[model samples]
Target: MRENLTSVSSLNMAFTDSMKPTDLSADKKGIKRKNWRRRIGFLLKTNSSQPILRLVKNRSYRPSVDDVNQWAQSLDKLLGHKYGKAAFHIFLKSEFCEENIEFWTACEDFKKLTSRKDLVSKANSIHEEFIRSEAAKEINLDFHTKNAIVQSLHAPTPTSFLAAQKKVYSLMENNSYPRFINSDLYKELCAAAKGEGKHIKS
Candidate 1:
């Protein structure tokens, strides 16, 4: 939902107008356009919790051709992956923007992550970091758990499901999850996991 780069579109032109070579503001700042064809590109980072809110450093996050493809694929994966979409729906409520190219920043920082066909590998990195932080009590009970569920969106087996279950249970145990678990999205996932008809909000 949150964008790391500003997409330039004219009122009279197609959205296909590529993102111009301009410094994506990490915050509120002026813009200077550059010749994109000559610019070297780096990558923008995202993860499980606020995956849509990618934070790119000034002049550092220029995206590689492959990374751009992967990031776009990541967006699609979030929409299709059950748990990822579910959790991200909630994130969207808090972060979605009208324009796809608005400058955005994630709520968390990542030290290292892997590259997957889409954003799955990046999401896994965030998930493992959250679990580690929670185990060490480095993160508060709320965020630690929320991110864990987001990671479970890529669940391919029972192990990943159980991992998400552990975090959800911890939330219930601490009595800090009423807002999160009671949401329409969470309940939808809960029902679908139980083989009920309702999985997505109508």
Candidate 2:
């Protein structure tokens, strides 16, 4: 009976030893899964927080226009208003031609740079990303404008992208601006603004 009992104890010890590696492996896998979940959660949290960042960085202030008629009166007037710029940007994005406005805005900022170092650096980056062949955000340009920009690259100035920028601006003014003025989004904004004005007057 003693020998039988000893044999049972030995079997139990062997079983426990065999389970150790499997149990450890399962624990490791569980930890890995938890870490993966945590990483995904972190990414989701970061992505969700971006809108809050935009809110903080971009002022909530909308240009107050007493009359919505001003927007329809002139494209220049519409382009000058903050709401108009935002609406136009959205429209450009919808059309997949956002690079036109983006390039134009970049040129505006580029012209404001005081440092030659910054000018050179920004010019190279902009040219590569938006003007070079098969660029990620290449803007449509005539051959003359393209050639001018390529020549300017040899000695980049604040106005290195001026020709290209002008072309993009013209494109927006002639093409996108007309569409934006007629878009449902613009109509909605106009309606909302008019409603706000009426509410205030009352």
Candidate 3:
């Protein structure tokens, strides 16, 4: 994998054998391949080189995770190897993943876009930070934990608190609780307007 990437990098863009950009780049987040020719480079029917590395082919620009998936699928058709499929997915997690919303929408995209279980926990942490940040637009957590907090605020009973704890447990089932509540969780709690239901004087 390293050799092919390096070899492709060393090849001049004008080289007769170098791949034409049909529609991909390592940085592009939302673009798809068919419309990519106008944006990046030409997609070709044949790999720019042969035998230097038979395992993979890439584009002039750094190929994005989406492109890698397509290329890997192409190779899968040619080689009939399951490893080829596995490697492509692993590459997607590494290449497309980001610590901030600027790169990825949420940590969930990392999993939805790729099939790497090894990445879920780490990605979940980063996603938790992103959720807590002011810039975040989406919130992700289990519904149970969220409702427990809401119900506790509305009807403060020991039973409710236990239910809330159980809900929190549900959200944090596999991992430790985060240091801070996410913006989405906060908003949900605030939206309940528990105290607004009645007026009280200090």
Best by lDDT: 2
lDDT for residue 29 in candidate 3, whole number 0-100: 34
Q: How do the residues 150-179 of candidate 2 rate in per-residue lDDT, one tens digit apiece?
A: 887657788778777777777777888888
Task: Score each candidate by Cα lDDT.
Answer: 0.31, 0.57, 0.29
lDDT per residue as tens, model 1, 15-84: 1122323334553122211211111111111222222223332322222334323323444433334333
- Model 3 weakest 10-residue run by lDDT: 33-42
TM-score for candidate 3, residues paired by index: 0.19
Q: In candidate 3, which residue ranges exceed 4 Å CA deviation?
A: 1-35, 39-124, 128-130, 135-202
Superior by lDDT: candidate 2 or candidate 3: 2
lDDT of 1: 0.31
Sort order, lDDT high to low:
2, 1, 3
Give the TM-score (vs. native) of candidate 1.
0.21
- Model 2's C-alpha root-mean-square deviation from the true structure amounts to 21.3
- Give the C-alpha miss distance for residue 178 in model 3, angstroms: 36
The best-first sequence of candidates by TM-score reads 2, 1, 3
lDDT of 2 at 26: 42
